[model samples]
Target: MEKFRIPAMRYRGLVEALQAEEIDFIDEAKEFYPLELVPSLEMTPYPHQSEALVAWKLAGRQGVVVLPTAAGKTYLAQMAIQSTPRTTLIVVPTLDLMHQWYAHLVAAFPDAEVGLLGGGSRDQTPILVATYDSAAIHAEALGNKYALLIFDECHHLPTDFNRVIAEYAIAPYRLGLSATPERTDGKHADLNILIGREVYRKRAEDLAGKALAEHEIVQIKVKLSQLERERYNQLIQTRNDFLKQNRISLGSLQGWQMFVQMSARSQAGRRAMLAHREAKEIALGTDGKLRILVDLLAEHFPARILIFTADNATVYRISQELLIPAITHQTPVKERHEILTKFKEGKYNTLVASNVLNEGVDVPAASIAIILSGTGSTREYIQRLGRVLRKGNVENKQAILYEVIAEDTTEERTSARRRGDNSPQEEKHKSGKLKVIYGTGKKQDLKAAEQLEINYSTQNKDVTNGVTDSSPKRRRNHPQET
Candidate 1:
């Protein structure tokens, strides 16, 4: 009896309406889908996200948007697609991330048909989500239709990756998204043009305590047990006595540096260090992890948790021992989805994962993150922590980060990774002395990736004021752009 005026450009429940007519929608999506499209992911652009959208529209072309992971960077892409309603090509890094982006975009635009171009090419909806490899390989087929390009993990746009971007269907508009705009091999300038440098960056620290929940960064030190302590003491004594007999003091510069130098120069020194570290891990890290998990369970009982590890075998081993299933790349798709769904639904209290699942996915249920090992990248460290901080439960007061580092070895020294360029006034570090792997910053906030340029055929975007844009025009394809 009542007919209400509804806005044509913006219609509510459009996705709901289309999904209700599943068969009709699928046929419509496959056959002659209407020109007007609607997205699935429901979101009102955050103030900052809106800012990024404005800058992208203002640039009138291609560029990257650098924003913290949880700061709704994915949402930025959603808005960008709406702003530029062209056949859009989205490139992500991994399968899990592909699913994550797929889930996100579907929620963002319910009325629009979406396609997966990676291993499984299901729905070739106007909005296509594919891995970087697949996107690059099929660029030619997609060239004519694709007018808008969106790269999720832009930093990986380097030597091998520049191709996917290069052959992109000459999409007039491109958007690169990443956390940091820094580069390791002096490629920051190139990235300036590669994905549009420093377009709009919002730091984790800014969002951590407010936009996100407050957090406590805890480093758990698992000391050796009595038996292990005895073994460690014996080894230390052997090394100490040998060094003493040789008049080698471990405190001075020559002596201290010499210790590490000896580790490199002498096999015996390396053996001694390795044995010592073994005792330390057994005494502290591994056992402590078990204990801490129990302890955390009691306090934050029934809460969702993400356990991250650098070692895959160890992850599976620990998962088995703990009776919790471990998720890896080898995991079957159906099983992996089941695991994630169960965890998300609170059926499983804790989930163990490798670095593969760390970068992507939205585990709104995970309020706690237990880091077992890492390569000292603050960016990854922080990113892992961000996993738990996404808006969640009422009782979940703050995010928790538990780091287990084996003390008295290189592992111990680098456990608290030095992220960012900031460091206290200290000693000299020779570049070639050791394999230097730097942290992106916080364990939860991985440091920005090293820079690589976006080789577009058109003129470069400006990065002087911390922004850039490639004017929307057709130019000769550069062998380097993907």
Candidate 2:
């Protein structure tokens, strides 16, 4: 029979199809080489990791592994690399992760050549760790260079551009890893075709107290001031009136899409949109929430803490008010790295960030997480909770995630939805891991409020961002500020 060629992605399937038809051919597509690799250090695999590795091998070394963050997914990838022992390429979603994987691989396999392909550094080594952007741009040149492809945070692989990195690859063995694989846009469905079906899975709750630290979720509801409540109601009513007149429902995805499309075309729609945002801002950034945060910070003094907010404005506000280091998309890389390193070394005891630390970035272990505000996405919730779930140096450490919700507002519904509960009226709901604390954000008596003092870190320059902590010994009688 005459010989013909196929696309690099189709090479594996075409070979199988031809073999089924009793066709013989000599194909020349793969350009990867086998490596003689041995790990320099000795480590034992956790039970879940071992089981996951076995499942992947049973599935022909191609599939996704769904393990929660802090469950050591990176170490599992290292184990897979050792078992397969091929010229491998590990693709990560961020430059930070690429450097992390590059460091781990280099240390684990000292004899094998490990290189990085992102962050302006391109090295042609047998084992390469690349960012998604870099790999997708050089997909054609890298199509046949690797025999195995391991995608870290594989949930990001299904994008229109990133999928080509997998499609143009001639690698037969593939593995995908992620804490949360489901996407809001429904692009995750393509992962089954790009990498393979999910072969092993484990949730944060499933691995709690074993592979991860035992954790508790505490939801605190705070009331807005009387004036703030009145304003919030007015804004929400204005938005709802428009929604009712247009017969638009924000409960459904299509309804929200229609509202967005209509909001851009007319004056009434724009006002309605503005009203909705203003109402949400009032609920999410209430002063009562800040009061509770001051109390929490004083209560958990000197313990490593992470504060999350929905917007950069809130992040900066909290950072300035509490004298904690802040990280956001606008933060410079060098400054962000310095802040994280100081936090890890215990020089800075607390950090406040927007959504920048939710994924891809490696955060140090913390016993407490205070979420000032967030959207109704379970993925984001899980990622934030995972930040404090890593097993720390303390014995029997209990990680606590405090979700401060604005009472009698839309945020309550959002909190319920994120916790997989649709009914917000159920004040005391216990769904597996999360427990609600009713009315914890109520204003404290004046005497108690006056007694509240924040004991910041003694190393004033570390967290204050160049502001001298004159009263570092004790900040007493700190008035509640709006």
Candidate 3:
């Protein structure tokens, strides 16, 4: 008989299949290492955290733990390290997160040598933290060195290329952590094969008043200027003409991509594609949104606020116009670090960012989050909301998120779709026929709703609350919450 090895992620399936055929195989991927656990700090896990640890251990030390951003996921990871004392490698998505993990690990185990393999540093020790890019580059060489593999923001692991790190590593103990594990392309299903099943999960609402800060989502409707509105309508008409003539449904799964490919074949198609982009830009970056933003900043003065935009151009424009520090992919590592440090120190009250801060970056919690614009992805919305949902000093300070939407455009549809609810108001919003309709979560004041051209019948309900439950649920074999 020949001896063969398989990835630990597939251990359960392979073992079950082998046992069905009456084949005997030895399991040795998790050989114990002579690693010492030096207690550097004393910290206690939350009740749900302790439950998560129990669920992970019950799953054979291999599974993903889904928790909200500020619900102490890092502490749970540290607890995992202490429970299973071994050479461990923690992989994070960005250098900022890598450094954050490194510092936390160092404080958790002061005597243990903590190494970093990203941001031009290449130190290897019992507890090592590396960025996803660096880990992918050196996965083969460091495959067999560690007994535990921890993936922070582990939802990124299922990508075609990033999966190599997990596949190449022989570590038998694996833990994946993320606030939201669902992906637009549905590759999150591959996470079950890459790491393990999601063993524990807690949503934003599940821990709202307890673990996470109590929060409220506010939706503001704004109108474009006449000139901008004219241009936007023209561009939208141009794109719609092409779609209607070609019988292309932009709502299909591969519709946008197919449109891109077909649009490049001729001048008309190219014009249509350009019109689509310009129309989107005009809708998302309308002058009205900026005016409202200025008002919001003034209203929330002295409160730390995070401004999220759909693109870097808008980010820079907001940064320049408002004089707030901006961090994008183009920002240097050192500059990003300094900006975050200053923000944490309360020197900078407001920060504007594109998509770079959406995941895994240890951003200092802010009291307010203003989303000027974003994609239709629920994950993006949740991550942006999470940036401000961390517990704050004021016990009753309701973390507020304002989703600014352009009235009477595809943006309204995008906002409704991302909210994952198909109420009558959403149907009306998707029809691209509605004017501004603003309502607080409280009982709708008919006079106020009518004054703003709102549909009281639909506006009475809270669409923002629906956003909190939009995230896809993970099926767990064991009870998720204790």
Top lDDT model:
2
What tens digits encode model 3's per-residue C-alpha lDDT throughout 116-209?
9998999878788998899999988777677678999898899877899888876667899998888888899988878888887777767766
Please, what is the TM-score per model? Answer: 0.68, 0.86, 0.82
Q: Pick by TM-score: which candidate is best?
A: 2
Error of 2 at 19 (Å): 5.6
> Which tens-of-lDDT digit does each residue in 251-350 have in candidate 2?
9789989999989989999999999999999998999999999999999998999999999999999888878899999999999999999999889999
**Model 1 lDDT per residue over 263-319, tens place:** 666777777557655644453345656676668767877777888877677678778
Candidates sorted on TM-score, descending: 2, 3, 1
Global lDDT of model 3: 0.76
Model 2 ranges off by over 4 Å: 1-3, 16-24, 425-482
Report backbone clashes per prediction. Answer: 52, 0, 0
